[model samples]
Target: MTAIKPGLKLKSAVCSAEVMVIKAPAGASLTCGGAPMIGAKDDAPAGAALDPQAAGGCQVGKRYVNAEQSLEVLCTKAGEGSLAADGTALELKEAKKLPSSD
Candidate 1:
């Protein structure tokens, strides 16, 4: 996989999920719906099929990140697929807690 960089947009080859790179480490493999994500301007493979095991369903307007904090993606469209990096699933970024006024 090519080195992913911030501001790069990607689209799922198997589903409608779309994402923009927030932060990505060099040499990381980004995937959506169990298939390699392509450039945002590129079209999905005509006969591609979704992998059942990777169908965790992504949420629109959500941010996903890996445990290592080396990769981050912001979903632009929702789809029946989960985000991953090098075969490991990414988790939704937790919401930040608000500071107390007291």
Candidate 2:
């Protein structure tokens, strides 16, 4: 778990995925590929591998949010791992429907 704020960059410990925090609650536990995420400047452990169950992969340029919608992150680089918070998988945030102009 880490104290994350908007604009903080995090990288996956097991994969190449990277994200920028858009919104995050204090003490939020963020993970990628079933492993805790590290600061962008931090180094990953040697021989780290992706977890099979969390290998759904993340898409570049997509925003993923938690169930309560309190946490959100933007994928800056796509990778073979999925994003999660507190052991729950984060889902892609759907685009808001625009009002039809009459």
Candidate 3:
């Protein structure tokens, strides 16, 4: 687990998913595809495999957030991985309703 802060780009260890920290509390464990994420620039070891249980697909440009909303991440690259924080799956944030121009 590492300290999560805004503007930190993270890459999934098991997949090609990439995300940027939008808002995160200290000491948040960010994971993707059931594997811990690393710094974007960090090289992923060869032959890494994704966890079968966590193989949910990630969408590009989606904002995934935890239940408490204390942690939020913006997906930059798409891949077969679900975003999670502290072992809890992140849900997509609902879009704001637009005003009706009657």
Candidate closest to the true structure, highest lDDT: 2
Give TM-scores for every candidate, taking all chains together and pairing residue i with residue i. Answer: 0.89, 0.90, 0.88
What local distance difference test score does each model get?
0.89, 0.94, 0.89
Best by TM-score: 2
Angstrom error of the Cα, residue 82, model 3: value is: 0.7
lDDT of 3 by residue, 2-97 (tens): 578999999999988999999998889898888889988887777777988888878999999999999999999998988888999999988787
21-50: candidate 1 lDDT, tens digit per residue: 999987888888889999877877788878
Q: Model 1, residue 10: what's the lDDT?
A: 89
Model 3 TM-score, 2 decimals:
0.88
Judge candidate 2 at residue 10 and give its lDDT: 98
Off by over 4 Å in 3: 97-102
Clashes by residue pair, model 3 = none
Better by TM-score, candidate 2 or 1: 2
Residue 7 C-alpha lDDT in model 3: 94
Off by over 4 Å in 2: 97-102
Alpha-carbon shift of residue 75 in model 1 (angstroms):
0.5
- Model 1 has an lDDT value of 0.89
